[model samples]
Target: MDFRFGDEDETFRAQARAWLADRLADDPAPDPRAWERALGRAGWIGLGWPGTDGRGYGNRCATLAQQVVWAEEYARCAAPARLGHIGENLLAPTLIAYGTEEQRRRFLPPVARGEELWCQGYSEPDAGSDLAGVRTAAVADGTGGYAVTGQKIWTSLARDADWCFVLARTEPGSTRHRGLSFLLVAMDQPGRIEVRPIRQMTGTSEFNEVFLDGARAAEVVGGEGNGWAVAMGLLALERGVSTLAQQIGFAAELEKVVSAAVASGAVGDPVVRAGLVRQWAELTTMRRHALRTLGATGDPGAPSVAKLLWGGWHRRLGELAVQVAGAAGAVGPGPWSPERPYELDEAQRLFLFSRADTIYGGSDEIQRNIIAERVLGLPREPG
Candidate 1:
């Protein structure tokens, strides 16, 4: 496949780069919430979403390549990591595919305007890799709404999100993937919803453990009992154009590792140089894979392959980062304290966080199973 960008794509890149540069200057806002609204106002929030109904949901519709361009330029600009990405990339696409027209009108505009944020409620303590094993239950309340109850672990941005898209077993006794429903619930349900941040070794709580006790879910997408399909579709979107942007960010991180190697004179070692070279080459391969598979919906294994590649590559990059940093990389910046226990530098943070890169978004084991069973037509491993 020709990975070259067309004229239209390059034009998009220029526009995105200029806008990102302008907004990211002066370190616009300390918190990303304000920046999200800024992106919405600038019409950069939902580039990949389809045009609205005549009532105007208010998002730009771009070609697949153009969406990739916007993401690339956003990363290249090093703009503050988007807080609205969960809504823009994952929920928006899922709603377009499965949500009702009324749901679209009500939800899409706020997301387009970046006024509300969303968190995914798929993974639980036992359902992290095996999502079909989720035990979260959403019982009907006789008002067309449901009361969601269960815990979701590793929910990124749960504390800040105004909403959560939860997958729960709508039918009691439903096991594995059956009888599930995808429900959208408000986050501010007093006494019903609680978000506890999971402090990682990085001394950060980007991921949280969310508890739902009789939380109200007003909207169900793809109808009740059809959540598995909807959730799978959303996961596909997770690994699609968004992965391209992630690769761009990875490129930036890789550059930092390379620069650290040079500064520490670790680039002179043949093994370190070989590792760096390997990372660069693999990144290129991943880029080409992304370009070639942009809209290839026929291949079920594409997303799994993508998850495997980036997850492992990021973890390895973290290892290379610490290695290139020499012995000094292992230490914290200042003396440990109760408030700032993990006062680590950039390399240590990367190393700690990257450990979960392979675990969070479907582990290496799951991806290989998908490839073997779905793509290669191999028999399923005996349970």
Candidate 2:
């Protein structure tokens, strides 16, 4: 497949570069609210949404590609990916697909503009990859809404979030994946919810434990008993397009390491240089596959491949940064410097976290099973 963008795309890229040069230079780090407002004003935030159909830029393949280009450029510049991305990337699309007109009107624009931050209240300590097994219950309160009560662990950014797109059991007697419902709950009210920080190896509290105690809830985006479908749809975005963006970001970091190695003569050692080259090739190849998946608008399962590949690659890149730096690398003051405790600390953290990459999205074993049965037509294992 030809991987080239045509002249129109090229022009768009140049325009994007100029925009970043002007806006990004003034603020190296993104202010979530400001950035969202900027994108919303430019009508660039939700490119995939069906366009206004008002002769304005209608939602189309071209719009999505433009956004992808923007994401890639942002990653290239080492910008921080949104911690509230779960709402923007996964939930918002699901809402557009299944939400009532009123629901869509209420949620989408603010999310697009970053006026509100969101988190996923999907994984309880009890139910993770086995999402169908979620035990968070939502019983009708008789007055109107449901009363939700359960604890959700690893709810990323819940501590600073405004709302949470959550999954809870609505029909206690229904079979797995059959009786669940999705709910959007507020994070500000008391007597219903609690947020506690969960510190990671990175020494940052990017995630939190969310406890729901009699929180008010609405029906799933569409209605009850349809949560399973809504969730599966969200997963498609989570595992597929989300991972594509991540691969782009990781590849950018890989390039920075190569540049540092060359400048320091660390590439002088033939073996070290060869290893770096091999790593770069692998990362680049993975990026191409990711981009192709985005272009084709392929299945959500496509993300499994990207995750499996990059999870390992990110860890390797970090380790190599340490190795290439050598004793001096350990010396303080750079991504490679071991002496800089935080640098070394972060490298170590990423290495440990990478081990969970396959498992988190689904699991390496599970992805292989999907390929074998669904993609490869293998015999299914008996229950």
Put down candidate 1 lDDT per residue, 1-383, tens digits, no spaces. Answer: 45677898888888888887776676855478888888889888787566444444787767777887888887777778778989998999999999988898899999999899999999999999999999999999999999999999999889889999999999999899899999999999999999998888887779899999999999999999999999999998888777888898899899999998998899999999999999999999999998898888778999999889899999999999999988888778899778776588888888889998888888899999999999899999998
TM-score of model number 1: 0.96
Question: The CA-based lDDT of model 1 is what?
Answer: 0.89
Minimum summed lDDT over a 10-residue window in model 2 is located at 51-60
- lDDT by residue (tens digit), candidate 2, 1-383: 34556678778778767776777788877776677666556554555665333332222334556666766666666655565477667777788778776677778777666677888888878787777778888998896678899989878778768889889888878767888888888888786899999866555776789989999886458698789888877776665445556766676666767776787788898987888888878977886787677645545457556666776677678778767666765443445445433543443554556655656656667667666776678898665
The list of candidate 1 runs beyond 4 A from truth reads 1-3, 52-56
User: Using Cα atoms with residue i matched to residue i, what is each candidate's TM-score against the true structure?
Assistant: 0.96, 0.85
Among these predicted structures, which one has the highest lDDT? 1
